[model samples]
Structures are given as C-alpha cells and as structure tokens.
Target: MSFLQRLTTGLTASKIGTDRFGNTYYESRKSWLGYGRKRRFVLYAGEPDPTTVPPEWHCWLHHVTDAPLSEQKRYPWQREHQRNLTGTAQAYRPPGHDYAGARRAPTAGDYEAWTPGG
Candidate 1:
C-alpha cells in the first residue's frame, strides 16, 4: 500500500475483523458520495496476495453480503480452504503432465484412425 493510502486508511478506516490467515478487514468510517457505500479492503498479514482471502471474507470485501458469513464448517466432511498453488511445487499435476512424467494408460475401446477416401 502507498504512503497516502496508509495515511488515509489509518485516519478513516474502521477495523471490522481479521481472518484466520491474519489478514485484517476494514471499511471506511464514512461512505463516499459517488460510491454510496463505504470502501472496504484487507491489510494482508505479509505479502499482499488476493488468493489468501477465503471465500466468506472475499464475499464481504466485494459487498456480496452486509456482513461476512460465520466461520466455515470444520467437520470432517468439509474440506479445508487452500490458497492458489499454480506456480508452486505443491500444485496439482495431471498424470500426463510434464512434471508428473507419466503417460496415461490406454483404454480398451480405442478409436480407429481416420483415413481420407479409404
């Protein structure tokens, strides 16, 4: 965040809540005339990564709901939230992907090759 933004936010933003990721959520104390709604934002715990924000907080930040939904279910049936891992080693790699280095097994019913006028 820029110095100006930091200054403005410090002076005008109200702390709403903090996510499990340690990111803090905030809203402007007063709404802007043009927007008709208070500005909302997150101060990341470390590096500013949009992926770090969970779905509930994401919705709140975007004004999808007046308030963030309660904590997500923690039961065994519910899968935990994971940030995007596209560029990391822990990211998912399909069986035939170069990183996996394994070709997919052929299926029993293979399609015949197309030939022109044969």
Candidate 2:
C-alpha cells in the first residue's frame, strides 16, 4: 500500500512505540469498518522477520499488553533482542552437521546403548 493509503486508514492512529530492531508500531483505538477490533499495524524492519520483535512489543502486538513498552519501566538487566539466525551463515551448526562435512567418530565410551533391565 502507498503511504497515502496507510495514512488514511490509520488517520486516527497514534504512534505506539519502536523497538531497538528498527520495527515501528502504530495503533488506532477506533474500530475500522465496524469490525470493532482495535486497529494495529507494524512496519517491520528490513526483511520482516517475526523473531525480530522483542518480548515487550510482542505482548502489545498480540494485545497481551495494552500499554506500550515505552510507557512502562524496563530494567537494564533484560538481555538485548536478537532475530532468528536460521539459514544464515550465522546459524548454529554442530560439529557433525552434514553441510560442514566434519563428523567425529564415536569411541567405545560414546557407545552406551541402553538395554532394558541390563
């Protein structure tokens, strides 16, 4: 949709908040087309990965929390947000992963197959 279309539908929308990942949230308390559900929209960052959303914003996005994270007090101990790394070069790969082509041979100690009542 063009900027004008989005702006028109959400003319009453107030900026909700933004996360560190560059995702922006907007919400309109008013109902749209008599649907009676609050209108909420998200302008996702670069590639639109769902995992990029933080817990606080995630709550608001799903209507779990009506108050935005920006309106609440967050502690410093909370860990930084991270997006899903699967399928990327940064993805985790075990030592025996097929793509890595490096498998470790199991030794006697590693072969401990359990037998019932043995």
Candidate 3:
C-alpha cells in the first residue's frame, strides 16, 4: 500500500470483521466528507482477488447488511465459495472446448436447416 493509503486508512478506518480467508474488513470511523455513509473496505490476506470474498461478507462490504452474518449457513445442495479461475489451468472446459478435445459427437439427424427462402 502507498503511504497515502496507509495514512488515510489508519486515520479513518475501523476494523469490522475478518473472513475465513483471513481478509480483514473495515468501515470508516466517521462519515466521509460528513455527507455520505462511512466507507467500507477490505485488506486482503494475500493476493487481492475479489472472488476470494464470501457471499455474506460481500453483502456487508457492499452495505447490503449492517453487519457481517454470524455464520455462512450452507444447504446440503450449496457449494462452497471458490476463487475465480477463468484464465487458469483448473478453469472449467467443456468436452468440446479447444483445450479439451475440440470435437463433439455429431448431432442426431432430426432437424433440417432453414434456408433463406424456406
């Protein structure tokens, strides 16, 4: 962080909570410019990846909730939070994707192509 950021955060930010990933959330101690709500922010434990934030904390960070939820209750069918892997090796690739095989089974001959005049 820059010197300016350190100073501002030190002067204005107050610790709100920490997430399971060790990220620390904060909100401003006072209203910003005395006109709007206090600012909210996070200090990432490691690399600053937004997707690392869990849903409950995300809601609090965005001011959707006044406080972080006490716990993240998961339903039996719910999957856990996962970091985005869009450009990484572990990202999802369908069977016909170029990185997979680039080939899909031929479609069943059930439909005919529509011509411009037909």
Order the candidates by TM-score, highest first.
3, 1, 2
Model 1 C-alpha lDDT per residue in residues 2-106, reported as the tens digit of each score? 799778878999889999889999999999899999999999988888988988899999999999888777898876667788999999998878888877767
1 or 3: which has the higher TM-score? 3
Ranking by lDDT: 1, 3, 2
Indicate the worst ten consecutive residues by lDDT in candidate 3. Answer: 104-113
Q: What is the C-alpha lDDT profile of model 3 across 22-82, one tens digit per residue?
A: 9988898988786489889998888899988888889998889998987767799998778
Clashes per model (N, Cα, C within 3 A):
0, 0, 0
* Candidates' C-alpha lDDT: 0.89, 0.76, 0.85
Q: Model 2, 22-91: lDDT tens per residue?
A: 8888887687788667877777868878888777788888888877666346689866566678899888
Give the number of the best model, judged by lDDT: 1
